[model samples]
Target: MTIAIAPIDPVGRAFFAGVVSGIDLRKPPTAAEVAAVHDGMDEFGVLVFHDQDIDDEQQLAFSRALGPLETATGDIAAPHERRVSMDLNDISNLDKNNKVVARDDRRRLFGLGNQLWHSDSSFKPVPAKYSILSARTIPPTGGNTEFADMRAAYDALDEATRREVHDLVCVHSQIFSRGILGFTDFTEEERAKWAPVRQRLVRRHPRTGRLSLYLSSHAGGIEGWPVPEARAFLRDLTEHATQRRFVYAHVWRPHDLVMWDNRVTMHRARRYDHTAVRDMRRTTLTNEVSSLDQAP
Candidate 1:
């Protein structure tokens, strides 16, 4: 079946987000449907599908239909202690036993970093292409996910600012993002596992050929700049990119699935009640080439 795409904005002038309908994600998609989704993603950057109740296996299958999946890694939880498979990211506040994690749980603390804007898997040598997040359970209020349109954000930059960022390279690390929250209790192994990776500060979308600012909370330093200066500059760019005009806040419902191109967007989860369960599973699509390898 063919999918339908509609702009999320009321007057249909929004440049970055759309709602996709007319196809059920619980079943595998036809080639045409897959192509339509890709087209929608290239044009919209973010796509939201509502009321499709799909489980983990179905979500993984549908995600794979779009692109190769990235293996989940570097979360605060150890392998044996994780509640979900390594193939799927467990974006939840629940422990392995399906109980709400304790108030001071290390995993929960680490997860607080999600509140900061970031591109999924930016810390990896090969960053993610797309991220599909499925909401199984959502809080009655709050816990919304916010996406920033980096492409539009780039378009809004002044000529000099754009030129300044166009050729820059930055180093990204989960340790840096988590460190921002004052959670520095990383095991030595964890530190090594999440060592910083370099990425272009500006990226060209492969399909649309549009330039986008690749800003993320994971970005701690630029290649040649001093640490303090680089971080301050990154913070300024993030603030500008996530301005109210450039962002789309998604108030999630149960069984909603939302996907966004990591190359053109940055996203973050909002605050929710720790005592409540907010189970979100995500499948990340691996980029064939890293930002380092891509044309600026």
Candidate 2:
């Protein structure tokens, strides 16, 4: 089957996202289709596919066709308590029994970090390259996912600010982001497991060779800077980067599959009723090289 891609943006602005059609993700994609998807990803940081209707195995198969998948780790759920396979991240409010998680549940509180803008797996030594999320079920209202185009954000920055951030490296940790919401109830082992990793503040995308500001809520501090100063700087950059013009808010529909390049965008989950179920499954592609290793 042939694949078609159309810009998601309205008539005049620079398009950072696209809607893809004519390829079924439930079955294994052909090599040519996979290459087309890669080309689409390089051109558009986010790609939306409607009516995917794929299960975990199909999702994994399709994601593997694009690149190596990153195993689910560092989740608040204990290994035995997880409802989904290790290969997929269970992005939902449901518990193992398929019931809505308690409002005060530690797992739920820990997940609140997702509401903050971040590039998936930024806390890892080798961060994520892309994230493919499928909407199995969606809430009747709210729970929209917002994505910010970091490449555009970087381009919009003043020359002086760009020069200042060019060589900066920031330390990222899950502990730091969750702490912002006062959810620091981690065990010593958990703390050790989620230890901070350093990444370049600006990255040059390997495929397009375009530069993007690599900012994340997971980033706690910039290397060699005082805590307050680093945090203030990061907060300022985040505020500037997430201005309405730079973002796209995606209102999900059941069976929708959205794939985004984590290297060039930051995304956050929107607020929704905790009592209503919103089931999303994500398969992330691993970045073999760290942002720190890549030339800025």
Candidate 3:
């Protein structure tokens, strides 16, 4: 059956659909809806599903329908499920159960940049292909997921800037990034585990071969450049890509599910009260690739 999709933002960067259209996400979607979602996702980076009751099995099935699930690495992925794909109900700095810790954890780490804007899995050797989030519960104030269009950003770049960044490889580091923020969750063991990884600065979509802004907050420095200079350049590039003109902010509702292409977009959550008990379930899909750890 066809789903009614409505564009949520001014630029129509997002489209809203109902998962409760009574089709079981556990099973495969008809060819038509799959085609439609693919089309919609290309036009509107973020696609929202309203009021779909799904369990882990169903969620997995739904996510895998898009592609193979992304295998999370790093210490945060130590959780029984996944760091990027699973949702935490609470994100307080003081809570031992908190997946990630920081003061105003929701604002600083969880929501601050969650709302800021960067592509998913852009930091990994093989970055994420798609991410689907199911919001089971939401806070009363300030919890939104915003997406900036990397493809749009790339298209908007001055021809010179595009040429300059195109072939450059940027280094991505969780250890260096959290350290920069003074967040000390990673042990020396963790640091050693994460050697640096470099990805092409301008990402080419695996399917469409479209170039997008591949840099993100986790991007530590450039592969061959001096650290400070690389950091400065990445910061400026992010600032340019996330301009108001290229973004679409999603105000989430309970049972809202959003899926986006990780290669062409960046997104993060907005701040909400930690005490408010917000929870969500997420699943990330990976671009088809073989598995093996690599050296820096």
lDDT of each: 0.93, 0.93, 0.64
Whole-model lDDT, model 1: 0.93
lDDT of 1 by residue, 64-171 (tens): 999899899958888888888999999999989999999899999999999999999999999999899999999888999999999999999999999899999999
Q: Each model's TM-score?
A: 0.98, 0.98, 0.81
Of 1 and 3, the candidate ahead on lDDT is 1
Model 2 residue pairs with clashes:
none
lDDT of 3 at 186: 59
Q: Which stretches of candidate 2 lie over 4 Å from their true place?
A: none
Sort all candidates by TM-score, best to worst: 2, 1, 3
Question: Per-residue lDDT of 1-296 in model 2, one digit per residue for the tens?
Answer: 69988888756434788899999998999999999999999988999999999999999999999989888995889988899999999999999999999999999999999999999999999999999999999999999999999999999999999999999999999999999999889999989988999999999998789999999999999999999999999999999999998898898989999999999999999999999999999999999889988997
Best by lDDT: 2
- Per the 3 Å backbone cut-off, how many clashing residue pairs does candidate 2 have? 0
Q: Which portions of model 3 show Cα errors greater than 4 Å?
A: 10-28, 74-116, 290-296
lDDT of 3 by residue, 80-175 (tens): 533333422222223345433445543345233343455665556676767887776677887777777888888888999988887787777665
Our model 1 lands, by Cα RMSD against the true structure, at: 1.0
